[model samples]
Target: MNNDESQPENNKPKYKGKYRIDSTRLPAWSYASNAGYFITICTHGKKCFFGEVVQGEMQRSPIGVIAQKLWYEIPNNFSNCQLDSFCVMPNHIHGILVINQIREGDAMNIRIQEEDAMNRVSTSQRGDGQRGGVTGLFNPMLSKNSLSKIVRWYKGRCSFEINQIYEGFGWQQRFHDNIIRDEFALDQIRQYIINNPINWESDREHPPHPPL
Candidate 1:
C-alpha cells in the first residue's frame, strides 16, 4: 500500500526513556553504505493525485507526468544515486534506488554530541520513531549523501514543483524503505513494482470499489 499507512508498532523504532534508542534499521549497518533500497512514498491521506490505472495501464495525469519526470532527474541531482525499476502509482511510488560506491568523507555517520542537557537526550526520546534525528531534531543535512537525505531531496523537489500548480499536493511525512539484501529480493521487488499497475484493482492503496 501507500507509505501513508501506518506500519506495525513492532516494525517501528522505539524509544525507552531518555538514553536508549532502538532503531528499526539493521543493527550495526550503515544506511549510507552502497546498497539497493526499495522505497515507497505516498501522498498525504493516500489521495490519488498522480492518476488512475485503466485497463492494466496507468493513465498519467499532469501531476503524474511531473512525478515521473522528477524521478528520472534524481540521478542528475545526486551523483551517487542511480535509478532502477520505478513506477508512479495512483497514491504512491515504488522505486529501486541504488547507491553506488561512495568515496571517503562522502557519507558521514551522524553522531550525537553530548555537550548540553538537550544533547545528552536521545533523538528519539520524543517517541516519534523518526530516523536520523540529531539531538531530538530531524536534520537531514547532518548525514550527507545518505538514503534519507536522497529521499528528502526528491520529496522536497516534488513538493516545490507540484505545489506551484496543485496547492493541495502533499506527501506523507515519512516514507517506507526496505534495504535490498540479496539479488533475489531485488528481482522480486522490481517485478512487484512493474506489476503494481496491472494489479491495481486489488491493491490496498486503491480506493474502495463502487457498489455493483
Candidate 2:
C-alpha cells in the first residue's frame, strides 16, 4: 500500500469528529453580562420569505415589516436590552443587541413604581389568564440578558406572526453571534449591517431557497 493509504484520517490536527464539533461560545463568559453582541439569524433553509433587495436597498415584504416592527419593540418587552443597527434580508437578519444590565432605580423605588402602575391600571386585567397576550414560554431557563433568550423570543414571535400569512414559516436551527470587545469592533459590525443590502447579490446567503 502507498504511504498515504496507511495513514489515519483522525490523525489530522484539526479533526474533531465525524459528526460534530464543540460549541462556539467563550468559556466562563456570561451572556447576560453587560456587553454588545452581533447576531445573525437565518430563515428555515435560507428561504427568501422576509423580503428582497432592490437598487442596493431592502424593500420590506409584509412579513419583513412585521419582523422590523417587533425588533424595535424588544426593549418594550425586556427593559434591560436595546437594539442597534438591525437589518432584514431576504433570508436572514443582522443586528446588534446591547444589554444595559438595567436602568438607575433603587429596589424599593422600583417596587413602588411597579405597585403604583398596577393600582392605576384597570382591575379587570389583574389576574393570570385574564389577558390573551401573556403566554408561557417553553424555555424557562431564559435569563434576562441571555443571547439565546433574545434571539429565541425574536424568532418565535416572528414565526408566530409570519405564519399567519406564509403558513408554516420557520427559522434555522440556531443563530451565530460574536461578542463586541470594543468600540472599533462595534462600529465595524454596525457598518456591516448597514451595507448588507448593498452587498446582497454577492452575499453567501444569496439565491435564496424556496419554502422549507
Winner by lDDT: 1
Clashes of each: 0, 0
- Cα misplacement distance, residue 171 of candidate 1 (Å): 0.3
Clashes of 2: 0
After the best TM-score superposition of candidate 2, give how far the Cα of residue 26 lies from its true spot, in angstroms: 1.0
Winning candidate number (TM-score): 1
Candidate 2 lDDT trough over 10 residues, lowest sum: 12-21
Error of 1 at 130 (Å): 17
Q: Give the whole-model CA lDDT for all candidates, comma-separated.
A: 0.68, 0.64
Error of 1 at 73 (Å): 1.0
Model 2 over residues 79-150: C-alpha lDDT tens digits? 778888999998888788897666675335434533543443343244353321121121112244466677
In model 2, which runs have C-alpha deviations exceeding 4 angstroms? Answer: 1-24, 103-142, 208-212
Superposition error at 128 for model 2 (Å): 37
Q: List model 1 lDDT by residue over 1-212, tens digit each.
A: 22221232253321111111112344234455678988878888888889888899998888989889999999887888899999998888988999874655444423222122244346455655544342233332334566777887788889899999989898988776777889987777777888888887777667773311
